[model samples]
Target: MKSAAVPRSAPAFTPRALACALSYCFIVAPAASQNQPHQGAELPAVVITGARFPAPAAESPIGATVISAEQIRRAGVLDVNSAIRKIGGVYGRQSLDGSPDFGLDLRGFGANSGQNLVILVDGVRMNENELSGAILASIPVDTVERIEITRGGSSVLYGEGATGGVINVITKRGAGAGAGAGQASGYHGSLSLERGRFDQHDARARVAYGQGPLSFDLAAAHQGTDNYRANNAFRQKSISGGFQWAAEGTRLGMRLDSARQDMRLPGSLTEQQFIDNPRQSLTPNDHGSTDIDRVTAFAEHRIGSLELAAELAHREREVRAAYGLLFESAYRSRQTQFSPRLRHSARVDGLHNEFVAGVDLVRWQRDTSFGSSASQDSKALYLRDELRFAQLSNARLAVGARHERFEKDEANAMLGVPAGAQSQNGWSLEGSIDVAPSLTLHAKAGRSYRIPNADENGYRSSGALLDVQTSRDLELGVRAGSDARSVTARVFRHRLHNEIFFDPTLSGGWGANTNLDPTRRQGVELEGQLSLGQAWRLSGQWQHVEAQFTAGPNAGREMVLVPKNVVSTRLAWTPAAPHSAELGAQWVGSQRYGNDFTNTCGARIPSYATVDARYAYRVGAWEAAVSGLNLGDRQYYSNAFGCRSGIYPSDGRQLKLSLRYQF
Candidate 1:
C-alpha cells in the first residue's frame, strides 16, 4: 500500500469544531449569478412512501430522502446498504459472518436494530417476522428505480415495527407512459461486470420489453468474493421478473423473485486477537446458507374520483447452518400476505381532501430443530386523511390511525408454551404551513408499537416471551430552498416503554429476552444540497443523537453501539458531457460496546473517518467507471458481540473497475 501526502490518521476535530465548520460553509456559500438558473424554476421530485398521495419533498409533512437510479450510478455503489449509509439519521453494520446483508439502526434503537426498522419493496413488506432483518441483497441494484426513506414514527399508516422509520424500494417495470399506451413497442437491455480486491467478481444483466398495454422486465445478478478475512467468503445469485398490463382505467401487475446465498462465518475475535491480526478467523469451520422465493400479484381500478387496489403475496425461505463441530441446524419458514386499499379524492368547501384506507393480513409459520414449530398471524386496519386548505395559503393537515392484533402459537420442544395473543393501537397527526415563498414549517406527533418475534420471545429455550414495545414521538422541522438548492433540519424526541432486548446478564452466561425500563431518545438531523454552477454540486449531512435508559438499572447511561454524532460530505464535478467524478468523506463517532450497558467497564470504541472517490465516462451506449473505498486504509470496527469477544472489523482499502453496455 502507498501513503498519500497527508497523514493516515483522521483530522483532529471535536464535535463543536465540526459543527462550526459545517455552519460556516453553509453561510459563506456563493449565490447564483445572472447566468445561473433560478433556484425554484424546477419542481421537486415526488415521493410515495409517507404521504396519502405522492407529493414533493417540499410539501411533505415527514422528513424524507429520495435516491434516484442516476444518483446510485454516479456514486458507483453496488448495494443498497452502501447507498443508504450516506444519508443522515441512518446507520448500518454488516453481520459478524461478513455476509452482504446489513442490520440497520434508525433513531438510536441499536438494541432492536432489526425489529425497529421497516423495509419494503414496491410497497410490499419485506422485513421478515423472524430473527433476521430484511434480505436487501436479494434485490439487484440494476432493477431499482428509486428508494424513498421516511424518518420518523410511521406506524399509523405502515402498520407495526415502524417505530423508527420506513424504507420503500421501487423497481422498474416498463418504459414511459407512451410505450404502455400503445404508442411504441421496443426492447431494451443492459449488461454490467465488476471486479475488485479479495478476488471479488460480479455480473448483472437486465432486459425489458413493452408493447401496446403490456410490458415485461427481467433481471439477474451473481456475485462472489474471497473476503479480506479468513473464513468470510460469500457467494450469491438472485433473479427477478415482472409483468404488467394497463388498459382503460385499470392496471394489473405480477412479480417473482428468487435468491440463494452461501457463506462462511468467521465469528468474533478477542481484543488481543484483533490487535495481533484482524484477518484471522475465530470460527473457520462454521458455515451458513439460505434460499428464498417469493411471488406477488396486484391490481388497481379507478372509477371517477375513487380508486381501489389489492395485492396478494407468498414467500418461502430455507436456512441451514453449521457451528463448527458443536452442532448443525436447519430451519424453514413460509409467509403469506394480503392487502386491500381504497383511495378517494374530493373538494370539500374549497379544500382539497384525500382519504386512504387499507387492511393488511399476514401469516407466517416456521419449523426449527428439535421438532419445534412456531406460527404467527397479524391483522391490521389503517386509515389516513390529508387536507390541503386552499383557503389558508395551501397549508396541509394530515391525520392517521391504526389498530392491530397479533396471535402467536408455539410448540416449544423444551418449554412447551401454549398459544398467546396481543393487541395494539396507534395514531398520528401532522401539519405543515408555508411560512414564506421558499420556506415551510412542519410538526408531527405519533405513537407506534412493535411486537416480539418468535426468536425474541423464546426460540432459544433459555429465553421467555416478552411484552410489546411502544413509543411516542414528537418532531418539528423546516425545509427551505428548492430543487436547485435546499436545506432541511429537524429535531425529534421519543419516549419508549417496555423496550424488549437481550440481556447477557440474565440466564447465567446465555442471554435471555426481557423488557427494560423506560428509555428516551432525542436527536437533530441536518441535510443540505447546493448546485454550484452548471458543472459542480455539493451535499452534506450531519446528525446528533442522545439515547439513554431514563429509568432502569442502567439509568442515565448511553445505549451501546449508538454513536452520538455522524457527518458526511460530498462534492461532484461534471465538467462536460459524458464525464463525471465525485469525492466524499464520512466520520463516525466513538460508541459503547454492546455488553457495557452500565457504562462502568471504562472501555469504548474509537472514532474513524474514511474517504471514497469515483470517476466515470460514457460514450454512445458504453460506460466505464473506477472507484476506490477507504482510501486512507483506516482500520475500524463496525460492530461488536460483547465484552468477552472482539469487534467486527470492516474491510480495508479496496478498488473496483466496472464496465457496462446498454442498448
Candidate 2:
C-alpha cells in the first residue's frame, strides 16, 4: 500500500506554541508560591509539550509528565519502560524477559495492555496491527533524549489506542538556545560501558554534529546476558541514525531504527514446576528469538502561515520460539507493515486551529508454522483537528476519525480455519481547557472497533465464525502545579462488547470474539513531583483499577491479570557538587487469570515490591553511576497465565553498575 503524492503548501510554526512554552517561567514564578523552597532541597525541573512541539509540561493542556535525562540517569533506567514505570497512572508488566510481551495498563483502561495505548517515537506510531499490540522492546533507551507521557484518552490528536494515553519518545536534537556559534556547529557525543551478574555485559555510544542548515546524529549499542537462570539467556544489538535540515522555511528529516535479539526463555511452567524448582527445567523447552528491522522518513515545510509534514515507513519482524518437552511444538511468525501519512496546520485569531488528515495503508503478510495460521491486509484513513482557545487560558480541543478494511489470506487445514475478510471503522473526540495559569482540565470520550484476526473470526468450523470486538471509553483529567511542585490525576472507564476469550473445552482452540459479553474497566490515578529545594526532590504515583465482566455471561468475574492497585515512589538527593543519590520502589497487585478458560484461579497474585538505590559521581568530562535492583532479594513469579495453572518466574535480586564519558 502507498500514498499518492499531493502538491501542498507549507505551514509555519505558530507563535502560540512558543508562547505557551515560555509561559511556564511566569506561571511558576517564585512569588506566586513563595512558600516553596528554591535552593536547599528540591526536585529538578523538567519540561515537555504533549503536542508536536515542545512546551513546559505543567502548562500542557493535558495530563502529562516530563522525565528529564538527569532523572533517567539517577534511576539507572536501561529502557523507557523502566523510566515510565516510575510514573503514576502508568503500569508496565510483562513476562520475566522484559520483552514486548509486557503490557501497559493505565487508568483502569488497557486491560489487555497491548495495543490499547499508543507509542510514538518522535511522532511515529510503533504499535503492531497483527496482534494490535505495542512492541516496547523495539526502541532502545540509549537513543532517547526525553520522554513525554500524556495519560488518558488522546484519540483526538493521535488515531487509535490513544484510548489509554500516549507516550512520545523524543530523540536528541540540535543545540539549545544558550549555545554559541562554535558550540552550535561543533560536535557532541557520549560512550558508556556496564557489567553485572548473570553474565551481563554491554557497551553503547552516540555522536552528533550540527552545522549551518544541517544537523545529524548517529547511535549504536549492544547488550548480552548469560541470563540469571538456566535456559534464560539473551543477546541484542541495535543501531539508529537520524538527520535534520533547515532552510528559509523548510525542515526535513529521516530516521532509521533497527534491532535484533536472540533469547532463550524457559517455557511456562505448570503448578508442579513452580513448586519443584523455579529454574530447574533443562529439557530445552524454553527458547525463542526475534528479529526486527524498520526504516522511517519524514519531511516538514513552513511557508508563511501554513505548516505541513509528511511521513513514510516500512518495518519487518520475525519470531521463532520453542515449547513443550524436548521442544516438541513451536510457533514461528514473520510480519511486515508499511505506513504513510501527511499533516497540515494553520492559525486563526485568539483561536489557533490546525488540521491533519491522512491515510494509513498497511499490507501485513504473516506466516505462522504452528498454532494460528494466517496472512492479511489492512487499509485505513484518519483525520484530526486541533483548535486552541486563546481566550480561555490556552485551552485546546481536538477530534479525529479513522476507518479500516481488513482481508485475510491463507488457511491451515488441520486448524480448520478458512480465509475471510472483515471491515472496521472508528472515531474519537477529546478536549482540554486550561482554567488557570497553574491548572489545566481535560476530558475525552471515544469509541473503537476491531475486526477479529483470521484466527479469531475465520477459524474453520469443525467450529464456527466468531464476532468482532468493540469498545467504548470515557476519561477526565486535571493537571496543576509549578516548577517547584506539580500534580496530575486522571479517571477513566471503558466497556468492551463482544469480548473474546480462548475456551479450550468448547472447540477450535477455545472462545471466539463473537461472545456477546461485556467487560468493563474503571480506575483512577494520581502522580505528583515536589522540589523541596535545590538539593532534594521526591516523586510518587498511585493507581487503582477494577475490571470485571459486567452484564455479560461471565458477569462479576474479575478480568485476569487486571491488578486492582499499583504504586511507585522515588526520591533523589543532590546536596553537593558532582554527587547524587536516588532510591526507588515498585508495587504490583495480585493477578489471577489463565489463557485457558477452564483453569480459572481466583487466587490473588501476592502483591510484591522491589527497591533500588543509585549513586552518581561526576569528574571533568566523565560521569559514573552504580546501582542495585531488588535490594531485598525478593523472589517471585513475573507473570501468571493459563488459568492460574501456568506461570513465568522472573529473575531474583541482581546488581548492575555503569560508567560514562562525554565529549
Candidate 3:
C-alpha cells in the first residue's frame, strides 16, 4: 500500500475558546460598520429564501448565505456544488459515480447526507423519495440567478429531509427577474462557449423577450467530457423554455424542461491501486445513461395586503446502468406536486406584522428492473408570523410551525428484499428576535423524520421494515453587519435515534443499510466578509463539526466520512471594471472511512487543501476568462466506502478558458 492511506489523528484546536471568540468579535464589530459597510461588505442580500417570502437577511432568523450569479460567473464555476461550497458551513463530497450529484453535507450527516437535507428549485422539490437523490448538474449554472443555503433544520416550511438544512436554487427564467428584481422589459440574451482539461467541451445559450405584460424565454446547454479518470466520461444536454404573463395584480407562468445524459462509470479502486494511479479504471466497461422531463405551471394574485400563489408540476425520469454482463439494471420514476400558499402583511396595535400559510401535496412512484416497486405520498400544512416593534430599534420577532404526514408502500422482492407499508409525521417550531437593528438572535427547535428509502430497506434482516429515523434539532445563531463587513455565526446540535446508514460489517461482512444506535451531531459555522478600499475584497466561511454515536460499545465514537473541519476563503481584486482576478482556497479535515462503524480503521481519509484562481476581462458585450483548479495538483481522496478498499481519488489540477457574449 502507498502512503495515501487515511489516518485518524486529532485536530489541533480548542472548540470552547474558538466559539467564544467567534461571537465576541462579530458582536463588537457591528457598531464599527453601522455608519458604513465594514470594509468590503458581503454581497447585499437580494432576498432571504429562508423566510419563504421576500424578506432581507437582517429580518430573518435562518440568515442563509446567498451566492449570486455574478459570483459564480466570475469564479468560472460550472456546477451547483462548486458555486456554493465556499460559503463555509456546508461540505459537498465528490460524486462516487460519473454524475455531478455531489452529496452535500450540512452539519455532518455523513454517508446519508442526501437524506438529511432538502433541495428546492424555484419551490419544486428536487430530492427523490428513493436512493436516486437530487441531480444538481441537470440545471446548468448559466440558468441560475442565485442559490440560498440555509444551514439548519428547516422542516417547518420545506418539510421532511431538512434536518441538516435546505438548499434552494433559484433558476433564471422569463418569470420576472427573480425575487425583488421587479419586472424586466425588452429583450435580453447571452451566448457562451468553454473548453477545459480532459477533452472537456461546453456550450450554452439563453434568450428572453418581453413586451408589456407578457414575456418568454428559452435556454439550452451541452457538455461533454473525457473525464479525469478512464471510463468516467459523459455527454449531457438540456433544454428549457418558459413563458410568463402579468397584468394588474395577477400573474401566471409555465415552464418545460428536459435533459439526457450518457456516462461511463470507472468504479472505485483499492487504496494501493488509487495511490498508484488515480486515473486508472477498475471496471472499464461499466456505463450508464439517464433521461428526465418536467413541466410546471404556476399562478399568483395580489389584493391589498393579501396575496395568493400556487403551482402544479409533474416530472418523469428513467435511468439505465450496465455493470458488465449479468449485473445490469434500469430504474424509472414519476413525480407530481401541488402547492398553494397565502401571505398577508399588516399592522397589529401599531406594530408591523406579517403572516404566511401554505400546503404541500406530493406523490412519487418508482420501479426497478428487478420487478420491485415503491411509492410515497405526502401531505403537509405550515404557518408562520412575524411582528415588529419599530419604536424599539426596529426590533422584530417571528415564530413558525408545521405538521406533515407521509405514507410509503413497497412490493415485490429484489435479492430477497422484503416490502412493507409505513406512515410517519414530522413537525417543527422556530423563533427569532432582533436585539438591535443590525444584530438579530434566533433559536429553533424541531423534530425531523425519515422513512427508509427503497434501497435502504432492500436488505433488511427481517421482513419488517427498518424503523423510521428521527432527530431532535436545536440551533442558535447571531447575525450582525452593516454594508461591507458582516458576520453570521451559528451553533447547532441534533440528537438522532434510529439513524439509518449502511454498515459493511453487518450480516457477516455483507454490507446492508440499517438503523443504528443513538447518535449526536453538533457544530459551529461562521461566515464573514470584509472589503478594503475599492480593489480588494475578502470573504469566507469556517466550520467545525463533531458527529458521534451516543450509545453502545462504540459510544462517543466519531461517525465515518464526516469531516471535522472545513474552511473556504477567497480574495478578489477588481482594480478596474474591465479586468478582475480572484484566488480561493479550501481545506477539508480528516475523518473515518465510509461504513467504518467499528472505527477500527486506524486510518482516516487524509485531510487535504487546495487552491484555485481565475482571471477575466470584459469589454462591450464580450468577455473572456481563464481559471485553474487545484493549482497545487495535490493528490488526495474524499470518498472511501470501507477501510480496505473502495477508494475514489480526487481530481488533479485542471485549466479552463471561456468566452461569453451578452446582448
lDDT of each: 0.79, 0.64, 0.78
lDDT (Cα, tens digit) per residue for candidate 2, span 23-56 = 3433354553436555534243344543454334
lDDT of 3: 0.78
Model 3: residues with Cα > 4 Å off, grouped in runs: 1-43, 56-58, 87-89, 173-184, 413-425
Q: What is the lDDT of residue 348 in candidate 1?
A: 79
lDDT for predicted candidate 2 compared with the true structure: 0.64
Clashing pairs in 1: none
Please give the clash total of every predicted structure, in order.
0, 27, 10
Count residue pairs with overlapping backbones in model 2: 27
Ranking by TM-score: 1, 3, 2
Q: Using TM-score as the measure, which candidate wins?
A: 1
TM-score: which is higher, 2 or 3? 3
- Candidate 3 lDDT, 507-613, residue by residue in tens: 88897778888999998888876555556666777789999999987898889999888877788887756888889887788888897888888777888887899
Say what the RMSD of model 1 is: 3.0
Candidate 1 lDDT trough over 10 residues, lowest sum: 1-10
The model with the greatest lDDT is: 1
What residue pairs are clashing in model 3?
6-604, 7-604, 37-483, 37-484, 38-485, 39-531, 40-484, 40-530, 40-531, 41-484
Angstrom error of the Cα, residue 29, model 3: value is: 8.7
TM-score of 2: 0.84
lDDT of 1 by residue, 542-600 (tens): 77889999996788988888888878888888776688888998888877788887787
